[model samples]
Target: MTRESGRYKGKRVIQGGRAQVRTVLYMAMMSAMQCNPVFKATFRHLVKAGKPKKVAIIACVRKMVVILNSMLRDGVMWDANTAKN
Candidate 1:
């Protein structure tokens, strides 16, 4: 992904994926932020490391996608403890 200055000054935009996919991932992230412990921890870790909130959110989105993909490839179900590790 690439970061660019957004129309609003001081805001950064993440660009690079298909808009529809990005939109869907953003939606999933909203839910993940509310209820997924692993995702919440990941977001908190990034922000605590000084990353911008949006940047941290995008990182979580990417992580979710990767986890989903791997689960599909391996025919495994979601496991919070495994995911946390």
Candidate 2:
């Protein structure tokens, strides 16, 4: 969450999606954070900035979801540079 945890907890991330897709996206995001330069740097920065690892992971996963949605909407191929932007 962006502000205080007390104010943000349980109300931060949206929790509505197909379980199967969520699981796959979570796994893919984890793997990407490990090997993809974009996600790796983001994870590193979040941790360095004092975010808990789980929080950082969730943030990355959310980002991936947004990127994926935009790609699908635009009918564009996946491109790391475009996603990063």
Candidate 3:
């Protein structure tokens, strides 16, 4: 277990996006992990698969970013079915 041991780990969202944007996204992901059906399920799945909590949260954040990008690009509204797809 030679992995760097510390309170900090991994690069922040997309290697240099706006700080405010990342902060807002991080907050949203945290809330989503607790309340949003889609993200809550994803977080639980990742943790069940042996990922650490922080790691799972980051993964959710990335998933959210991709979902947001795709929706924006396609000019679609948020849909529960779309989260599954």
Show the colliding residue pairs in model 3.
Answer: none
Give a tens-digit lDDT track for model 3, residues 1-85: 1334476586543455577977898899998888889999999999999998888888899999999999999999999788865
What is candidate 3's CA lDDT for residue 17? 54
Model 1 per-residue lDDT at 56: 89
TM-scores, one per candidate = 0.80, 0.73, 0.75
Report clash pairs, candidate 1: none
Clashes (backbone N, CA, C under 3 Å), per candidate, total 0, 0, 0
Candidate 1 total steric clashes: 0
Instruction: Give the per-residue lDDT of model 2 (tens digit) for 1-85.
Output: 2334555555355466677987888899889987888889888989999999888898899888888899899999989888777
Q: Which residue ranges in model 2 land beyond 4 Å of their true spot?
A: 1-19
lDDT of 3: 0.84
TM-score-best of 1 and 3: 1
Instruction: Report how far residue 3 has shifted in candidate 1, in Å.
Output: 7.5
Candidate 2 local lDDT, residue 13: 56
Q: What lDDT is obtained when candidate 2 is compared to the true structure?
A: 0.83
User: Model 1 Cα displacement at 11 (Å)?
Assistant: 8.2
**Model 3 quality (TM-score):** 0.75
After TM-score superposition, what is the CA distance of residue 28 in candidate 2 from its true location, in Å? 1.2
Q: Which candidate is the best by TM-score?
A: 1
**Which lDDT tens digits does candidate 1 get at residues 1-85?**
6565456456555677689988989989989988999999999999999998888898999899889998999999999987875
CA displacement after TM-score superposition, residue 56 of candidate 2 (Å)? 0.2
